[model samples]
Target: MAGSAFFMACAILVLFGFCVEAELVQHTFKVSNMMVRRYCKNKTITVVNGEYPGPTITAHEGDSLAIQVINESPYNISIHWHGIFQRMTPWADGPNYITQCPITPGNSYTYKFNVVGQEGTLWWHAHVSVLRATVYGALIILPRAGVVGYPFPNPHKEETILLGEWWKADVITLQNRALASGSAFNISDAYTINGHLGDLYRCSNKHTHKLEVEQGKSYLLRIINAALNTQFFFKIAGHRLTVVAADASYTSPFSTDTIAIAPGPTIDALLHADSHPSNYYISALTYASSPAIPFDKAASPYASAPPSASPFDNTTTVAVLSYKSSPPSSSPPIMPPLPAFNDTPTAHHFYSNLTALHPNSVPLQIDQRMFVAFGLGLTPCSVNQPLCRGNAISASMNNISFSFPTTVSMLEAHFRKIRGVYTKDFPNRPLVAFDFSNPSVNNQGSFQLTDKGTKVKKLKYNETVEVVLQNTAVLAAENHPLHLHGYNFYVVAQGFGNYNKKEARKNYNLVNPQERNTIAVPVGGWAVIRFRADNPGLWIMHCHLDGHLSLGLAMVFEVGNGPTPSTTVPPPPQDYPTC
Candidate 1:
């Protein structure tokens, strides 16, 4: 009997090897213009695979996937494989201005890379600035052989839900207007579930996407928050969701009735469908606060009125989480009791223990510290200045707008070196000073632009470093989603208001506090991160908000001295952008 069992095990191992060798798959997709009249209005918008929040591309671990992204739009475009480890695979990183030139209109580029890591929730999106607002989709990686379905029991069905923001106006025009006026330029009227804003308007009915699930069975729901600028709270009326993964990595499973997810974050949950058949709404609501308004105690003839209340109050339904009808004429499905936010003891303990296990893993360190200030206010222009002939309302980073360098050949070329025409006479300290809690500030603040913003702080190949990002309360009271390229970092510490230099030095989590590619700098707060500078390449560290980055809230870092000369790759091939 033991001999027979050994023979059966050997046969199973042979079959698995054969499957691994033969199961690799490759697919090519196109990014082109499609007529998607979202919200029932006959409007046209850019899309991937002729759909908003394009099709989900799935692959197993150890598989090589090739995607041929053809750009048929009237503008330049590029697709980034978000949250993937593209260390040596620079070509597939998809930074249009960095790794390669953009795929111009009527042009095509093939992105090929091996999926060499563990499997979890991943995604792809346009990485060329504003293009991501409209073009994004899910990239799911299934587990390798012999691994069980997930930490929890296998579900009856699985679904991929992507949340996106919709804009009816032209994206370029909307951006330009915001730049010129220096105010909120929200054109979106409704949030989208799988690309459709359901039942909000007459055209909403046409593009609705629905999920049909079975009653009394478990289901796996992979949720991706792909919205451009909104953080959301999600909950289903009749089911409890056990969150098992975050940011494409598995965490210890924690059950909750509601989950808060920020942009660029992904969460996977297991939902046990109700035994009795009943329809219920699966809702996602924005957690954004209203923009602050300047108060006027005395009313005048020309005083402006306050902005009206937003339509997205608590009662709005984001999506329906309905169970299929069953026999026996059942009553309403039972709802699980909600968990308190502070009661996330399992998550806290898991993250804390993980950090203890990996204590010496620091990624990026402070060879030199630079202070940057961001804020919005009215300021008088320099005499006969092109942009400031009068007092103009504006927003700035380090108190300066992004002026394209006239002498540079291109942004990518200029970013390759630490010292250049762009780095001349860099400032030693922040460019603005104001109260973060206050909505407005005085106009006498100083602003300057320097080449240091593009400079590279040198790192030995595979050296560990810790960076403390101090928020000095110099801008509006708002959280900034800080994103880094080339390497993911462990968030060692975070706190409200200015960073306590003494306290942070003693209690830093150098091991593990959730390694991530992007982190949130809290409103009126600071965050410290650690990363290993092992990947040799030019990388960007910037705010994820496209508008803020366009204004000047961005910088580049060049990690040099790799093992191979090919690490410093040449320029992209000619005819790169055919459009």
Candidate 2:
């Protein structure tokens, strides 16, 4: 670990996307309690720097950042820089008990890392328990100062649109109740745009987030879906979005009336304000792919003007996109046509259509291949188990329910040779193969139960690996957004139904497939991703839905050290949190 003097003195000249001198940036986040009112209810929630959506962190490519988090709040917490390739600083890759223990209440920890290689929008959020419901903020990286221009024409300006969820009850309390009962958590009260609940709810029309734009000028919208579990369809009334990036990686620009964004990825789109100088509604609503789960009959009456169609936050959060020439009008703004809640085809088309902006040599040969079958499941209950009123609801991958270590972080255990914290015996494929995509198979005794343990898979450093993720229909069929912590992988192909090894290989897009840190496996379907295990550390891969993740839908990959020092993970920071 470097001292404050060295941190301030160390500077270097480098060329990555541009030539410039790299410097260290610093920020402080004080996690404290704040009282907020929404949907006619007042509640105290945990927040950073007392901001509802938290504070944004901005950096140029090649720059380093040192963010000190002061945990004044009553809960232990840690922050994860989503989509960042932590490089050699895996100790700073925050996921409670995975990378390091959470910073206890009144304690503090500084996250030091470098932003390199990638430039665009990413985000940071609490990775402990369920605090991410409110503890999230945007992380934006720009091209190095000396860069000439972006891949596409630079927009006249840029704006950050953070789509999120809001609840009337205390988030921690809500989660505890759900866990204690071994039942699904109650859905959110409403969805929000930049923390505003919009016109659909009471006392929100005046507080709705509004964006003013100039006619004929294009604006780069750095949109992030910070929702805990829901995927959203975002659109503006009379405007076309030219998507240029996903998960901070540039993509071939594609025009669309709407964008389908899952929980963990950030999207960059160019919005042209060419319509008549009038007010238009920019709306975001749940795109629920799980048709099997029934709708929430108790959904808040303030959710929307019309009833909700899905079980998840069946609400639309709105913002006004107004041209500079127009003022607030009494007439209602036009609403964009949103697909049905279970419009799987629309979601599929949006994901498969994206390709890399610049093609790179996608690995044609694989050194390792693995098939992972994952979904929700149930564990039979004993009369002694109080939490399991009937049967404990759970989820798993390859029939193994991931259990986290309580004494030390997984990375620490691997780094210091600590034993018994976890076992490197995670299965690469299902123990017993069956019809994974068939709804009827969910009734079978073999397919519905899962075993729990802290199991992981080991991989050789620098080995090219391919993983086929197949979503099962054990409990319900829903789109599972799986996020990998350490590296971005190429989403080569995706399709509905079981993945046929022989037939799926033929449809692989080896040339220009989209690269993403998070991929949403289609509901009752499968997707293929390929990447090289270059970074050394314990990297976690899990469903982005917090509920599913809590239910044990996750696993870890232990990538061993590489040949050279530059490719190896360094010693832990002196201030690394201890369990």
Which is the leading candidate under TM-score?
A: 2
Give lDDT: candidate 2, residue 532. 92
Give the alpha carbon lDDT tens digit for every residue of 507-545 in model 1.
Answer: 776544666777656555667777776666556566665
Top of the candidates by lDDT: 2
Q: How well is each residue in 104-125 modelled by candidate 2, as lDDT tens digits?
A: 9989999999998889999999
User: Where does the lowest 10-residue lDDT sum fall in candidate 1?
Assistant: 300-309
TM values, all candidates: 0.78, 0.94
Instruction: Estimate candidate 1's alpha-carbon lDDT, on a 0 to 1 scale.
Output: 0.59
TM-score of model number 1: 0.78
**Candidate 2: worst-modelled 10 consecutive residues by lDDT:** 300-309
